[model samples]
Target: MTAVAHTSFVIERDFLASPARVFRGWSELALKQRWTDCHSDLAGRTHTLDFRPGGSETVTMRFPQGGTCVVRFHYFDIVPDRRIVYGYAMELDGRAGSVSLVTVEFAPTPAGTRMVFTEQAALLEEGQDLAERIEGTREGFDRLARELEPAPARP
Candidate 1:
């Protein structure tokens, strides 16, 4: 028999950059590639982003041990530098693994941008790595913090 699990998580992060900058980190394909891969062990194969309502984003990666995972996201709403809501799905070696509703919101704070990321996921039999998933997501945010830092002054 097939099994399914449900989980929802919220992660908050503070970035020392403007809300626009923080939003750009997620909205721009190139910038997003710099920090979105929480699983360093996975080799990214392709990434495409369309940052607008009715658009979609997709990424394909190869797991170190074997197999491939593809992530698909369909944009449902976008509010410039403030918020984004999307539907997410994941496939492993062409088999459906999970589906989720994801929302990310950004707000300006004295320190900089305060971002909240929320994901509600339904995990199919092949997507039972909830703990690992959360850890990877948290690590991705840590990488985002580093990516948001201003470039070093040119020599």
Candidate 2:
């Protein structure tokens, strides 16, 4: 027998940067690494991203205790500096963990840009960590904010 669950959530953030800058954070490999998991303890991690419509991305993370997490994403639609839609599936140590559809929308705001992230997921066995998942997703956006911060003026 297997346990399955469905959930969805939305996370929104405002960055002190332009929509183009914010969009590049996800589109560019180096920029994406600064905010994503290049800094994690995922040994032998492999990541590849193709940012155009119909393109795909794959990210693998290894856990210290046990199990490996691999996420594969396929882009369905992309509107530069506006919106992106993708569907992704996760495998945990060879076991299917979840599948999700994600949409990110960017809008010009007085402060700079407002990004809205929505994820609808179908979670599988041993994958009932919804709270942690939401927190991790939020943390990624936080890292993006830090990544986009302006450097201090040199003396």
Candidate 3:
């Protein structure tokens, strides 16, 4: 049986803002925090993003039960207003665990930008299934969609 698998999702959002503005939200720290970090339900979690090739990002999710998980990503490619490619790994208190590849593409639309995200993950340990992981990822993207809804008009 194959231990590696790929999962893909396409998300379209109508932004009152232009594609350039939306793309900036993906690459800038302050803009990313507005949509992503502020919307996270996990308490006390912190996110650090470095937007550049060979840069890295780390998100630490702290649990009320005194446990924490850190997600780390190493940026491989970054194109302004277009795409981002990275390698990701999850760690339990700094111990490396599962690894994956992620690609995010942004295309200009009549209204805004259509974003497509794809991930290829490998289960390095026994008893982990790709289907389960992919389903979780799909749910995550859905949550992102909710978080990124367009704002009301500014008077």
Candidate 4:
């Protein structure tokens, strides 16, 4: 059998919240659904997250065109308030699809938490190029940074 080759992308973002808060946002299903999964034009989509080793996260995104894609992540390790390591895959109607490794690290900062995310993925039959996928992933993280920001206080 041929082995799955991988490509990676790294992103760093600073949040104006405490490490614990940021970690909670990353781990908690409710907070994650707020900034994630619910964005973009995908309506009526929902996500379920089980934030622990051997736990799993599933997101089903529905397009306006009546198409749907489901993505799943199986957690391998979780370090409280610090890091998460997981394996991910995408499927259409429960069929085998792309696979990847995802790692997120959180570090305490004077302002708040410094969050870093890295994803290494293998293109399955879909055959997406590494560079294009990495660029798109970076954009997704950029959007997440904006989504996570709290509203500015009025003068």
Score each candidate by Cα lDDT: 0.91, 0.90, 0.69, 0.77
Clash count in backbone of candidate 4: 0
Runs off by more than 4 Å, candidate 4: 1-5, 93-95, 127-132
Sliding window of 10 residues with minimal summed lDDT for model 2: 37-46
lDDT of 3 by residue, 1-155 (tens): 44543344344444444556666766777656555553255657788988899999888888766667888889999988788899989876665557888887878878666777777766555566666766665555454555456766999
- As for candidate 1, its clashing pairs are none
TM-score of each: 0.91, 0.94, 0.73, 0.79
Estimate the lDDT of model 1.
0.91
lDDT of 4 at 57: 91
lDDT of 1 by residue, 54-94 (tens): 99999999977889999999999999999999999999899
The candidate that achieves the highest TM-score relative to the unseen native structure: 2
Candidate 3: which pairs clash? none
Clashes of each: 0, 0, 0, 0
Off by over 4 Å in 3: 1-17, 34-43, 127-132, 146-148
Residue pairs in steric clash, candidate 2? none
Against the true structure, candidate 2 has what lDDT?
0.90
